[model samples]
Target chain A: MLLKTTLIRLLTTAVTLFGVAVVVFVLVRVAPGNPIAMMLPPGATEADIAALEALYGFDKSLPEQFVIWLGGVLQGDFGTSITLRRPVDELVLSRLPATLELSIMALVIAVALGTAIAVIGARRRGTATEVGLDLSSGAVLSVPDFLWGLVFVLLFGVLWPVLSISGRIDPQIEVDFTSNFYTFEGLLRGRLDVVQSTLSHMLMPALALALPLAAMIAQLLKQNLKEVLLQDYTTLARVRGFSETSVILREALRNALLPTLTLVGVQFTFLIGGTVIVERIFSYEGLGNMAIDAVINRDLPLIQGIVLLFAALFIVINLLVDLSYTLLNPRLRHG
Target chain B: MTGSQTHPNTLDVMQLNIALPNGHRLLRDVSLSLRPGEVRVLVGESGAGKSMIGKAVLGILPQNLKVTEGEILLEGQHLNAMTPWTRRKTVAQSAALIPQDPLTALNPARRIGPQITDPLVRIHGWSRTKARETALALLDRVHIRDPKRVMESYPHELSGGMRQRVLIAAAFAPSPRLIVADEPTTALDVTVQKQILRLIRELQQETATAVLFVTHDMGVVAKVSQQVTVLFAGKVMEDAPTERIFTDPRHPYTRALIAATPSYADLDRPFSPVPQALIAELQDDIVRDDARHQGGAR
Candidate 1:
């Protein structure tokens, strides 16, 4: 029964993804000026535009274009980027690692900071500690990611000069496997100094992106923990002589993780969107930077591919969230 | 009195008074003592402070409740004087509570075995294997048909009756000296209620564990209790052996309560409500007595 249900959900998700792809494709194509015109120069003749349009298959009907594009996508051909003149797969894959690293770091920071603040706030509910947590989380959420990035840049980059102001790494650093400096290739050589510098450079942007997400998660966890704390099992645990911290962490928090898990999944999707502005502010060469560049250059295939990647990510994340519900709740697993 | 046998008392609540934050007293100098192998039932109406007494004995009162004036002695030791930590280890070891709502009482996310063995591991420092063995035995004692299956099941998987039985098993896992069961079978069907009550009685007898059973149902009180304390508006109106109380209730409120109870013979007769005037009089008397007692104690 469980396997059947999971298969059904997967099939439904696939249909939903296809629907989303169709809508995004048509909406991007029909929004305004043609992709062919955007690629042409100012004094181009009608014949020149028509030839280019036919060459790129822009002259075909919308449905035909959709089928062709989807077929190519299914065949592992996402088409070539008009701006970079490179294959969309190569461009996306090249930027994928940097984006994943930044997102994973931001997520780790969010979970750790959010959980700590939430636990402390829950333990000291109705006290000054709770008030302080509420105020700070609210303040952090109010400040946008770009503003936060700029503030950190001003502090660490301008005032103290402890970190670089712009760009991912120092241009002067050489790419090698041994030397320790501020470059990714240098870290591949087991260079601890290079790893350190790269981490320092990424830290501010990562924090800038994580603060709002952390605040949102902390608010969710604190409320959930408080409600679970009032449950009878917590009382029973207390009467059973379990210490306060053990009951809170083992019993209360474990039950609270279900909601937090769902929230974290959603936050992950938001992080992709949030990183766009943060990347622009910090000039970090992540997927968000590539996305912005694609939009500016009106690279249709590149934009479509990135959107598809994000949608696929969202679908996988939701599936994992659904599966985790079974792991966290045994009743669901057995029943 | 001097030559009387020196039997060990499992629990002693002396001149206990509990007041709610709403300026109403829940328990009024209601004292009771349980011997090593006794089942004492606190029987009254829904708001008669029976469960309040149970909470006070276990030191698990909800927030906004104050003990006001009282002493709870467990195994001849002062429970009120011990620190919460020491009290948690020793006093809690001596007593456990089977709450009214078994569905919410056990952690839904946890397996039944771990929930039952938590106290054994935390308080007694038992190994996991030992705790598991004890938990299975307890499940068996509570008449769980398949102890192994029950151990693996979560609370949500069990029926209401099964969950209550599981809770009973957990309460008995530590072999506590006293078990305060507050309306354990109230949420089950009539047949399941009988089964739960019978299981509780049999387990108490086998373990020689004293039970402070709280219920509004006089039928349940008659079935399991050796002695009965009748509470009206948070005060003990009468205290005696169960048979004697059923046959010859001395307190007026106790008499009205018994008369109000539906029986097999009275099922055909139109159900009658206890007069509001009498309930009001009882409430006034309890308040007056509470104030007088408070003044005298102070």
Candidate 2:
């Protein structure tokens, strides 16, 4: 049963991704702008425009152009970026590490703090502490992440000025990065200084992005935990002489976490997509930051590449969530 | 330690009153005692506070309800007088609950082995190996066909009867002096309920554990309990030896309950529910009693 579901999920993911690629391709073209016009200087002639369009296969019909792009994409080519004159796949891949690092950091922060606060709130349910948590989390959730990023910049960047507010890392920290994943490569090389710089720069933007997501997680998880705590098993655990902490942690938490995981998975996909504005705010050169540049410059291939990567990421994360659901829930596993 | 000459009752609940925050009493002046090796059933219809009594004794009552006036003694220890932590520790060391709704009474994510052994190891300070062995023995004793496999299995893998049996094994594993079997068989099929009741009875007798069995089924009470406490709206309608409860019930509510129970042997007997008039009269009497009690307090 597990194998069958996984095979079906894989097939659906392929179909969904193909649908996304086609939509993105058609939609980007349909928008009122010619990539070649946007690329050339204001004084360029019609001949120059026609030559550029023909060179990039833009002169052909939409279906013919789609076939050409699709055939190139099948063989690891995502076309050349009209703006940077670089391969779109190369540009997206180069920027991927920064986004992944930031997203993973934000998610870790969100899960840890969110789960901790939720546990505290659930344990002290109906007390003043729980009310305070509800109100504070509500307040946190009311604001969008980009606003949080600006506030973070004001508080930690302009005011206190203890941590780095802009960029992936300090240019002064000279370390040989073996791969684009600077933090991982630095850690592997035992160069803590490079890793430290990467983290210090990541902290503010990541937290800004994480705070709202954390609040969302806390609210959903706390509510789930409250309900689970009232289950007969939790009461039975108490009757068995288990401590309140044990009852909550051991019995209630596992039951509560399943629904929270679903929420986290969906929210995580959005969080990655949300990084577009947040990355710009921190001047962090992640895919989302590059995505904005691609849009402004009408870098069609780059935009298509980044959007497709994000779509693939969304599908993969959702698939992972489904797989973990089966793994975590014994009922699903056995059934 | 008096060589069994004079053993203290396993559990003692005196004038236990559980009330909601709005001063609505859920259990009114309830009292009972259970000697070691005794199985006393608290019999009542739904909302009659039968299960509430069991929860009260085990210190697992709902947070919305408070034990306003009560004292519970477990093996002569004054549970009400102790500090909260101490009370919890004392209760944990001696008491267990076999809960209603077997489906929801075991954590679904956990394997049965850890679920059963955790209390033994944590509360009783037994080693993992010893607890595992004891759990295995108890599971086999409950006639679980494959104890080893069931131990590794999650609660969802087991049938309702199987889960209830697993719970019974867990409850008895620690050899707790007091076990509150709160409708353990209520969620099972009819045939399964009988087997579960028999298993509980066998285990209770073998371990000499005092069981406070809560049920609305008169048949279960008759089959399992030596003494019966019949409750109606938190008030005790009758308390007597099981023989007298069956043969010569004094309260009108008790007679109505007995008459309401359908008997397979006498299929011709008309099933009569507790009369509405009697319920109204009982409610009126309870209101007067509550008013008097409040007035006296003032």
Candidate 3:
């Protein structure tokens, strides 16, 4: 049954990805703007434009272009970006590490801090600390990440300036690197300063992404945990001599994590969508910005490629989450 | 099974009283004691505080219910007077509870092996290998046919009876002096209930662990108990030998309960709830008792 469920989930993911590919391929074309016009020199003649169109294969039928692009994609080619004059795959890959690092760091902060706050809230249900944290989380959730980004920029960036609010690192400092991922490259090169610089730059954007996520995670887990604590198993744990800490962290958290896992998966996908704004605010060069640039300049190939990548990542994450249910619930593994 | 005895006064609840933070009494002047290898069954209706007694004995009352005026003694040590952390650590090692619902008693995420070994591994610092072996042995002792398979399977994978058996084994894993079985068979069928009761009895007798069995079922009491403590609205209505309580019950409430319980000879008998005025009187008694001991528990 587990195997059958997994197979069904995989098939659903494939169908959804295919649907997204078709929708994105059509949607970008229907939207008004022209990458061809933008790429031409200011005084270029109509004949020059048509030559450039023919060269780029845009002069073919829309179906022909899609089929050609689809073929290349199947062969691991994402076509060239008209505006950037680079392969869409190369552009996405170069920015992929930064976006992944930011998203993961944000998730880690959200889960860790959110869980800690939630545990405190659960333990002190009606206390002032619980009420205070709850109110703060509510306030944070209401504010958009870009707004938070701006606030963080002024407070941590412009005002106090303890942490950089934008970019992957200080553009002034140069370093020889092995990987596109700054922290990994710094660690590999034994450069502590570079690692620190990377972290400092990531702090504000990560915080802007994390605070609202943490609030949501806290809200999700806190309610479930409070209910779980009243369960017979928690009482059993107490009777069995498990420490107060152990009961809350291991037993209570394990049961409370299921619903929160779904939220985390959804939040990750949302954060990728959020990257356009987050990257723009922080001036961090990631696929999110590349996506916006593609859409505004009507870089059809780049937009199609990025959207497909995003859709595929979302599908894969969902699959992993579906697999995680068996881990969280033993009953599911048997069924 | 130690096949040897330890303390005569394994557990002693002296004029125990439990109340909410708002000062409403939950248990009033309730007291019961257990000697090593003896089973003392707490008999009461739904709200008679029978389960509360088990929790009190284990020193694990819910936060709302305070032990305002009682000292629970374990082999003569005053558990109520000790610091909470100290009391908890001490009670955790010395006592174990077999809660009412087998389905809810075990953590759903963990397998039987780690869960059963929890007490020994966490409390005794046993290595995982040793703990798993000990857990498997305990499962075998509980008559689990495929102990290896049972150990590997999670709580949800096992039947209710199987889960109860795993819980029974876990409760005995630490070799506790007191085993608080709080309606351990309430969720089982008649046959499974009997088997679990018998298993608990056999294990308690073998280990000589003082058993505080809390249940409303008189049949359960008849099957396992040596002494019975009958409660009414949190007050002790009667405390006597099991045979005496069943054959010649003194309290009007006890008499009514026994009358309510249908026997083979009395197949058409309907349950008679205790008189309301008598319950009101019991409630008044608790209020007066609380007023008299206003500042602190006696």
Candidate 3, residues B177-270, lDDT tens digits: the string is 9999999999998879889999999999999999999999888889999999999878898999999998899987888787667687777776
Name the 10 consecutive residues with the lowest summed lDDT in model 3 chain B: B1-10
How high is the CA lDDT of each candidate model? 0.84, 0.90, 0.85
DockQ of each: 0.61, 0.82, 0.70
**Candidate 2, A1-335: lDDT as tens digits:** 87897798889988997898899999999998778887789999999999998998899999998888989999999999988989999899999999999999999999999999999999899999999999999999999999999998999999999989899999998866757898999888898989999999999999988999999999999999999988888888888777787788888888899999999999999899889999999999899999999988888888899999999889888888988998889888655
Best by DockQ: 2
Against the true structure, what is each candidate's TM-score?
0.90, 0.96, 0.91
lDDT of 1 by residue, A270-331 (tens): 88778888888888877789999888777888999988887887888778878888899776
For residues B218-252, write the lDDT of model 2, one tens digit per residue: 99988999999999999998989999999999999
State the lDDT at A233 in candidate 3: 90
Model 2 residue A261 lDDT score:
96
| Model 3 alpha-carbon miss at residue A35, Å | 2.8
- Candidates in order, interface RMSD in Å: 1.3, 0.9, 1.1
Query: Highest TM-score among the candidates is held by which one?
Result: 2
CA lDDT of B284 in candidate 1? Answer: 82
